[model samples]
Target: MCRGWCWGCGWCCWAWWGRSPPSCRRCSTTGRWIICRPVPIRRGWRRSRSSCPGARRPSWCLCITGTVGSVPPIGRPPPLRSPRSGSGIGWSPSRGGVPAEDGATLMYPVASNGPGTDEKLRDAFVERVREVARSRGGLTVEVGGPGALAADAGKVYESLGGPLLYTTVGVVAVLLILIYRSPVLWLVPLVVAGVADFLSMGVAYGLNQAFGTSVSGQSSAMMTILVFGAGTDYALLLVSRYREELRRVERPYEAMKVALRGCGPAVLASSGTVAAGLLCLLAADLNSSRGMGPLGMVGVLCALLAMLTLLPATLVLLGRRVFWPLVPAYGSEPKARRSLFSAMGSSAGRRPLTVLAGGAVLLGALALGTLDLPGSLKQEDSFVDRPESVAAMRTLAEAFPGQGTQPISVITPAGRTEATIAGIQGHEGVAAVERGRTGDGWTELSVIAKGAPQSAAETATIESLRDRLPESYIGGPSAEQLDLKDTNARDRLVVVPIVLLSVLLILVALLRSLVAPLLLVVAVVAVWAASLGIGGLVFGPVFGFEGTDPGLGLLSFVFLVALGVDYGIFLMHRMREESLAGAEPAAAALTALRTTGGVIASAGLVLAATFAVLLNMGLVQLVELGFVIAVGVLLDTFLVRTYLVTSASVALGRKVWWPGRLSREPAGPVEQPPGETPPSRERVAVG
Candidate 1:
């Protein structure tokens, strides 16, 4: 509506004038020049498009540039800024105060809702800071801080959203095709797994909302991995058994029923063990670990339900066609392939003692790698690939050494606010103190540490402050990390025993023997240790990870112990069935390995591959978790379940089932023809 004489170029409303930096292009939102303050742009200054200042950096604006190719707005209102991209890319005087000149850096900090957590807040704060920088034109504005980094990372994460799911599905689909040797067979399992995934999400969301469960990207990703990984394992065992039962039973429904009866106990036991093990995370003090307990359980239970109900129903409906070219005709026996498991069983059967000893030595050696694992992970080093927050933090570390960027928030009673601040001020490492918002008899204080955030010095300062002011609560990323490490330590003490006890109870109930259950538990525990040892040896050396996730020990122990026991259940259950049906100890052990070995191996592969998908994620925690779990699953599948456990069972004879009826009562005497004498026990043993 009105126009006036602006700075140097033409008529404008604000009368702002300055030399525009050549490196600073016109703002994308309004096509306006940004006057980078203090220093003029050098000919080859590195131009980064992400100079949008948020509360932590210099302030800026987003008006059209008068000197650019596009005409600056003369009378029409400024263009509407896009909340996504148009952050503090431009600067103006009217908004956030004047930007500091070169060598006069300002300490402005914005309270972010966290990167990728709130788009609107991120944009608004970035825009506000850009305006402050724009107010002082020609200066090389320092548009940086933690908020800026988080915003950039958030954008990147948002862009990569849910594509991971598609990638995972595709990976699993190919593996299934190879495993089943039927394109059509993979589809039913994928559909069923997908349904389980969606249902788990809803259940996870409900848990998050109703119970305030913490649902992070990492946990959600792990949940998906579990659903597909464990879900497919269950599906594989069921389908493999179904194909076998079909040869004996005429109808698909009858085959399905008989198949369920045969393998269902093992599958049910496996899922139950995993669910119960994960639920033990409730004992964890860390919010993430505690929340993961329920979320993980939900994913596993959902997968279990899908595999049991949907997969079976679909397979029964599709019947013979699902098998396609490799179809197992009703009344036709499965093709006999000399499988890898059979070969392994042969080796174990030949020299059970030697195989058992060598396997034990190998595992023990690998377990020693645990000593070489990197230290606890730093907050900034938590990601597999550095995100914007990490970059900003790095830049800040170099630019402003010995200064903390994130605030140490202290919540104290309103009446004790002054005393808390005084105590914090007197603390050794504190650099500054700023009083903040107050409400409901509580006062919030932001304390700045002289040392960099999460530094040893900063950690010391935090501990000092917390100790002195017992009533005041101190929290931030640094505090959270420390708490995570400490709480995980405590959780391991409480949860590991619970998990072991729970798994042992489940195994005893399934196999119905003390020694058998103990053998399975000890085998899985050793596998977990050896798996972790492998992680320690390779995480830093091979993958370049500097530190292990704090929860790595407990989480890996729970998963490897639970999932590893899955294959053991299949093998052990088969051995128990054979023992009761009439096979002697050594024969039963070998027979179990021969008959059920292929299916268990297949199940292990599915589970291992599913967890390996986490290696493709962004965070180092997922990568480590994925690597260890995958390795452990494979170990359980091939080495432990196939050789070690089988050898132990064979070597121990009837004592393997100690105190059970199968152990106490030898196989019933065979009734022979009148002319035939019963074969001696010693003769049978030699045979």
Candidate 2:
């Protein structure tokens, strides 16, 4: 009972299409002349009782083209019998059409009642088609429509489900092994995060069943990825701090307590910001976008719970031997080594203004790549790997030069049906029209356009129809995509500022300085732009993508600005702590960067790699999203957070924390660390 236009994204539009009279005489097949009229798939229809000139009965075949939302009803109807002859079957059909090879002989063009888009119904139809095809010897009966495509897409997802899970687990295990350098230690984070992931799924399922929240392949994939990624991040921060605390506290449980106390605020803040920012998507009118908010929040919160509660508990139970070979001995200072962050800090400290200006210029320049970005992606181009639906559409495009294969449905109030149909017929782009099911107070009108689906002329016609028939809800796959595009634009105006303002407000509260929060916000926002710009440059040339997804900018912006601030929180909090402990501003900046740099770097690598897994998905949108977020994390890690932020802090000194108590208390010259020698003309000072 799918009454009108429905969409599973704008990737494919489905409709039944064929050409032939509703019912023709079988004897007429001998004649050259033939005509097609719109046929209804309803239970009863009038048909002429006649035989073709050469045949005893009418011969006919039905062909269809569309996605899951529509399909023709199964089996030919019984011939109409005259009231005087109850035993007589009276209508005849022509079976004179030539074999359809590469769509060479297609003359008739119309659709019948399609199998409508529903998971179970589509599955059943596809199964039935499969039996028919097999009996006829390998797809001899071509039901070229979206049912096959929808059925295949479902199968693809089912096939991919197991492998995608294994891939995520495998990647997480290997990365944790590399990071921990311990056989036993790596297992803890993986096991805990995996549990959290499983729990999130249960919770998501409950939400769907209880609240009727939308759940789809896209939303579920994003949810699982976020859990593994952000969970690992919280784990890294806690574990790193725990290791450092172990050297001072002597006991494992005591050390865990100390580490949690030290890093809890930052971890809490980081997860909170991500959750709040994702929740902003609830404002989107699109169901996919709206549903993702709760899924993402569930993922983040589940990860946070695991990291804070389960992660620590597991580590405490494992004891210090978890680190085995590299266990931190009590009362020993960590080996003094000049790491990359130390060198970077020294460089930025020496020439803060130069580093800041150069990084800013680089970001701005990369952002110029937006000019090269292509237009919006078409439905056929939405997937990285073309599915059966897209292949069918492509075949039809080649077969029919200038006709629409899919239907654009206009569902109007029953009272205005005539007026709506009249207005639609008067539209410039229409090729044909058919009246469909009437249910409730609505009448369904299916329209075939003169232009191909999703073309400019068709797009204009859709808009024109909407304007002319205001009482109708005009929709289909193409129309849904059009609505998606418009909604994304509207969301940006409303949601982007909320995201920025939300992050800004959080940062200001955490740092207690308008200038410092402003700097971090501006830096991350630039990172977002630079990341998208990088996507623009590579999506077309390197990846051979058709065009950028419309939702790309908004999703990427939210993630980068929100998640990008995680490292900032870790670094700036440490810097503030050091400044409060009586260190000079420059020394505090350098010390904070040197101490937290490795942990933040490792966290970024884990988060970025986790997102990079999305590249393996079939959808081009996911690939683009994965690529941009991964690239942005690396850029934020190696460039912005490490260099630009530190440099700015070094240059601004005490003023970076303006209006805060630390700023007023700091005035001393930068002091060298203990055992460091004074600088000379030949050597650069290390503070």
Candidate 1 C-alpha RMSD relative to the actual structure: 15.6
Tens digit of per-residue lDDT, candidate 1, span 527-584: 9999999999999989999799998999899889878887788788878867766788
Q: What TM value does model 2 have?
A: 0.80
Clashes of each: 25, 23
For each candidate in the order shown, give its overall lDDT on alpha carbons. Answer: 0.69, 0.69
Model 1, C-alpha of 558: deviation from truth (Å): 1.6
How much is the lDDT of residue 354 in candidate 2?
97
Candidate 1, residue 284: Cα displacement in angstroms equals 2.0
User: How many angstroms is residue 436 displaced in model 1 relative to the true structure, after the best TM-score fit?
Assistant: 4.3
TM-scores of all predicted structures: 0.78, 0.80
lDDT of 2 by residue, 399-474 (tens): 6656676667666677888888888888888987877656556666668788876778788888888788766677
Per-residue error at 507 for model 2, in Å? 1.3
